[model samples]
Target: MQYFIQRHPLNYDGSQLQSLFTYKNFGLMGDSVLVFRGSCTVEQNEMVDMEDVVAQDWIHSEDMLHFIVEHFDMDLEKTIVRQRLLIATIKEELEVRGVTTLRRSGDDLYAGDKKLSVSIATLSPVSTLVHCGLNISNHNTPIPTIGLTNLNIDDVFQFGESVAEHYCAEVLSMRLARCKVRGVS
Candidate 1:
């Protein structure tokens, strides 16, 4: 059996997106049989109480381990256990930064000493690939040559111009801003 997932990627903002997206088989393409889901499904780590058992992260479940074990044939019980333990710590870090990481399939959040019932949408590995393919086709050009770190001041301006022209209807103000700095960061 092969597994592929498709979901829309979260935008920079917290708004829900209308466009559908996908990722390709969760990076498992070859019939040669690469990693199958790799013991990294969101459900394994987070606990969900759907009914709001308490006001905090005190929700209850028998355990998601079986669900995970059922999903993967590799029998990675140890990996899942370790990852589940680390999830709380990672959630704390995300809370400190005020960034809530979410996936499309699960419902639960760890934020600032609270376990809240939350649902977020995220792209599957397949949706990500589809987005890249569409971007390539629309541009009708080779992939970008220079990484962000390699960009110079002129390159930055040019890149902004290209983005503005393609995405924005008006670039006169943006073009003016590009030539001058407005204020301190």
Candidate 2:
């Protein structure tokens, strides 16, 4: 370690290396913005930064995001640490898409006999409007703009069944394409 540091000095030039430096500052240029289009963060996730994205910055209102979405199969013990890592991963990806900060929202499981809608709602009406596609019903609620966390998963089978029924699709087909549970474990 001492030899490596002596060979290549990493002097802190008094400018104070902010965490934002990790992003490589791609948001400065007008033409270099990233783009991604897909159902990227269902079984996986997509995170955005709040500080990087301004109020006036116009983003295309599509279900797709303009960044790389990652999927992981983790078996960690603690939720807090998992949340922190997820936040960091999401932050890095969001920066690539010209966004900053995250807003954690409460998740709701709306279920009926053959219907269900799993949605997460932000604390801020602005965030809810901006991210979650929320409407006028949340005008009275305030959106928190600090730290963000991910929601938990439950009964994927039930969810799949509901989605298939609602959309008139095949549950087995989707599972065959995405799941890794078929072959040898």
Best by TM-score: 1
Instruction: Quote the positional error of residue 168 for candidate 1 in Å.
Output: 36
Off by over 4 Å in 2: 1-77, 100-140, 144-185
Candidate 1: C-alpha lDDT: 0.24
**In candidate 1, what are the lDDT values of residues 106-159, reduced to their tens digit?**
223322333322222223222211011001011111212212211111232233
RMSD of each predicted structure: 21.0, 19.6
Compute the lDDT of residue 67 as modeled in candidate 2: 21
Q: Using Cα atoms with residue i matched to residue i, what is each candidate's TM-score against the true structure?
A: 0.21, 0.19
Q: How many residue pairs in model 2 have overlapping backbones?
A: 11
Give a tens-digit lDDT track for model 2, residues 28-74: 21111112222212211122333223432211221222121111222
User: How many steric clashes does model 1 contain?
Assistant: 9
